[model samples]
Target: MRPRYMLSGNISPPSSAMALYSTPRSDKRTLQRNRRWPGSSATRSSATSTLSRSGSMLSSCLQCRTSTCRRISISERVICLILHSRFSFSKYMSESHLSLRVCYRKIAVDEGGLPSWANSKYRKYTPGKPHPNAIEYLVAVDENFFAFNITWPQDDSKKYDDPEKKLDQMRAYVTYFVEYDKQQLPRSKQPYIFYIDSRWASLKLMELLHENQLFGVLSCGENMRPKVLWSWIKADLAKYDWWSIGLPRLSANLVCVRTKDKVYLKILTNYCALKEIQYKKRKRKFPMTEFYVAACDVQKEYNAFKCKVDQLNKAVLEYFRLSRYLDDKVTFTQFFIHLFTVQSWTYYNACTGRSLSQLEYRVLVLQELAVEILPPPQPSVLAVHWPKHMGGRTHNCQYSPCRNNCTYFCIACEKWGCLKCLEKAHLNG
Candidate 1:
């Protein structure tokens, strides 16, 4: 008897596979063109077409290495499996702005299936060096680490001096967030705040955020703002350790804090006032482990919520690094698989309060998928009875009185057994 694992299903392909493997329109055209004449020997092209049609199912089945997914296209097979298994995990969303911590992070993917046209148009070049071929994705996540708004792969190359062109990619990011926010949290009364770093700060973006009735707490850089104002702020830092200036036209205020060694942190926001609030930080000198408290509401809010997106990025990288599996042929499949894993992990942790680590959760998911979708290995030699590795799976030894788990399957006996069990069952008998 076959050993049951975490999940059980009939050892057959689902009905949905039939729809996926149905003859495509282009294949039908080839059939009409390659029809053999009744009275003449079949042409080479006709024979070729016949062979291809006959081999399609066999090839697809081999590619998946599974009888249950026989004849299903690889892309469709993966997507179908994902969709089918999605019923077990629930989707989660923030209820309102009070609980929502909106932040943005750019996910840089190296050597994926990004289109060449967009790549060339937005490729970045340093003063004396060429940047790598990579696709940059703008991802926005809530406090729960759920990535609600994700952009398609785009080039991150931008001109630092031109704020308009600099935030061209941000347009899509903001649009997606706004649309999703309206649909998911329609009853929430407070405006949504988008937390972004200095690279994304600009007056034009501020206007767009205000237009959408959203707010932002963006870290500002000298190069990202007008030179005159930036210089004024830098010089004025000599007289005062910290100060804020309000821009009446943009309905935003620029706040700068002069830290130890004259290093300054600047923030631009329409939501946060120029009032001070208590916050703690590590000392900036040697033995920096000591904590100190300061009063600044803008810095406090920015520091408290700025790392949500970074945390999400860290989780995606540290837990399941998908870069090694990313290839041009299966880029789409692998990318979505990673995305789904992240979403599932976040939602599971939020809803269940489970103490499972990210790595453990991923392993559990893989085990569940293997039981449901993966097939047993084919026998190399039917005439010979020998044990074969079960592809990292373990089953109870089928030999009577043997209670040990085994990773090897005996072909002739059609049973899972350890080496000792196999030797005793076959050699002794």
Candidate 2:
């Protein structure tokens, strides 16, 4: 039988909390009716009766109990709830053309204070990074603002030979999604568009995407191949201000745009067309520029949907954060725990069509988990026994089942009994 959690206390936020989300009348009513906590009297009684048999309670030893509680399994329960519902994962994937954003998150640590057992190749402290003394992870997030793929943690302390194994890591990350689509999202026919930054973008990676029938919008640097286009764009930067200078290619379109700040933004996209390039002009004061900032269709599209992985990082960090002192395994475990919570939160929004603040959702999840993992308190048993000493007195046993004369008295019940009756009255009781 499937286990059900019946929490026996009020754990929901006040009704006014719903006002913050401005939830619809129907959703509000549903939440009030369905939110589980101190449910009906029958449920509470049933849960109490099943607590010991269900084996949900923690062990007596602290270390053994901690080891038994697996957060990953708990997260899987959240996924199970979503899967059993009418909401179809494959359908959702097919309906939306998701933008897959690839990025990195630094798991900072203190090098000097690290424990002796923390001897990992990837846990070295680089001198000049934002998280110089930290471990790094290659993370991928979709348009839903939830991370679905994560690479093994990289060792940053080694010699800076390659840029995070540029082409190799990209292929690995893309391969995961491709396989996932084939298995879990069989109906998802459309290919995903990956948003890659200039540092990680390469010709080989672009070719890989093409071979897989996927699309990508990659940022190009000034030194990127095809020196002719970069040279022309740099020479005539002002002329292309507020204009999308398109150099169409067989597999990609090289787009260059100049903003009022005098910075040239180079973009390479396989999905965009020369005719689809939308340009707009906005006048500026201060410097008295003719057209301040040019908004190109390619740039606008990239800016709007990209950086979702970064956004995921922001969302996770806003509430709780993992301790830096943990080892690599424990740290990654904590990171995924946070990601699972965010995933559940995103799923809730999609299912309900209402936006509940992250904080509130986290509170609700905590309360629900409390019900699943916390066991009901047990009633204290009365310990019935006699005093250690016996005075020179004889009396009949006061126990209902015994009829004897002796000098044994039970201090617990303040009763008398004989030697044989005392054993049955107190010791065996």
Candidate 3:
């Protein structure tokens, strides 16, 4: 018999009080945030029940359960999601000109089972099938945002006995990663970070990173382990973007690196925006009038509401534990489910014509407790309009390099100098 698993829509919360309320909740904006609905809070539970239906959808798709893997069936929502994802992944595969077989993880015959595999000597190391490296790929998930880290070791011998196979594997992995980022992850919210240790840094990989618009330190030698607080700043921020200009490694001292990076400064600048965002959040605030009308005892109603939330959250957490992220299909489908579900709940709340209760608001706030959004980049003046001492400064002599400012500038040096200086600056001045 297949057990059923249902997934309904929900919303995300603010970043201030994540620890207090870990359940999914949100406001009017984020999940297509301002969407409208025809129902009220009374129907919210029904919506969740309808989505889960028999809980079969996820069971069929992923064999895991909330606490343990069990026999289960797939939900219509999850099935449809899987189908949609296949189409998208197919399109991506076609565009990248890479075969699908290569992109997915390689599965093997393990008939002997876990105990046998565990006892084998070959299994102790990289073995026939390679084990994943911690530094190479790491995922740090919070309520609103996720941070991923990818690195290559100083020595590349463990991956594959054949060097060519390793490179192919890397390319395939990177292809999926890039696409997964575009399709699933929300880059508009904040830039994704990538840390490429110089050890196995490839030209093609670096090019891919730059296409995403980030910084890089042109290091030719070994990796630098961070020692100081400032350098740690670079280390921390570098793991969250597609390409990070990683800290220049110079000995064990953090300050020894040359040319400080603006990423840290930019990150610091975002703190102010983060605070503003926090200030703007509406939390733990419910519609008192609606609550008063709905129940004779507001306190009792509040307690029941809190209990309901807790129970639902537990179910969600349990179901979520079953799946693994080996492909974009699962990640994206799950994300889509999570995304729209959140919006639906928020919209439903609005329809309920009730103000959010303190407990509800707190749950919403918890969703974003760890998430921090980076402020949009400020607009910059064109190079043509910049002052000579700004980006316009040139190492060339006072001679202007261009003739548009010929009256008072030196065309040879792009300097704002008298025409006379053009002739004498290089030779005499």
Tell me, by TM-score, which candidate is best.
1
Every model's Cα RMSD, please? 25.4, 21.9, 32.5
In angstroms, give how far residue 149 of model 1 lies from its true place: 3.3
- TM for every model, in the order presented, reads 0.56, 0.54, 0.21
The number of the candidate with the highest lDDT is 1
Which of the two candidates, 1 or 2, achieves a greater lDDT against the reference? Answer: 1
For each candidate, the alpha-carbon lDDT, in order, equals: 0.51, 0.48, 0.26
* Candidate 3 lDDT by residue in tens digits, 114-224: 111222222223232223211121121111121111122223355323232233333332343444435532222333323222232333333333443322221212222
Comparing 1 and 3 on lDDT, the stronger one: 1
List candidate 3 stretches off by more than 4 Å: 1-124, 127-156, 159-174, 177-191, 196-208, 211-429
lDDT of predicted model 3:
0.26
Can you list the residue pairs that collide in candidate 2? 122-155
Clashes of 2: 1
Q: After superposition, how far is residue 330 of candidate 1 from its true place, in Å?
A: 3.3
Residue pairs that clash (backbone atoms under 3 angstroms), model 1? 277-296
Summed over model 3, clashes come to 46
Candidate 2 residue-wise lDDT at 170? 63
Write model 1 residue lDDT over 1-429, tens digit each, in one string. 221110123232234432221222222222121112111322212111221211111101111111221232223333443574442111222233123222222221111122221323333332311224433334555555655434443334442445556565555555544554445533444456778766667777787666666667888777764645555445545422565555544456666776655678888777765444456667657888856555457777777777766566556545333343345445444445666566555544543456678778777767666755887777666747888999889999888799798899977778999999898888889
- Regions more than 4 Å wrong, model 1: 1-133, 156-159, 236-240, 319-326, 374-429
Q: How many residue pairs clash in each candidate?
A: 1, 1, 46
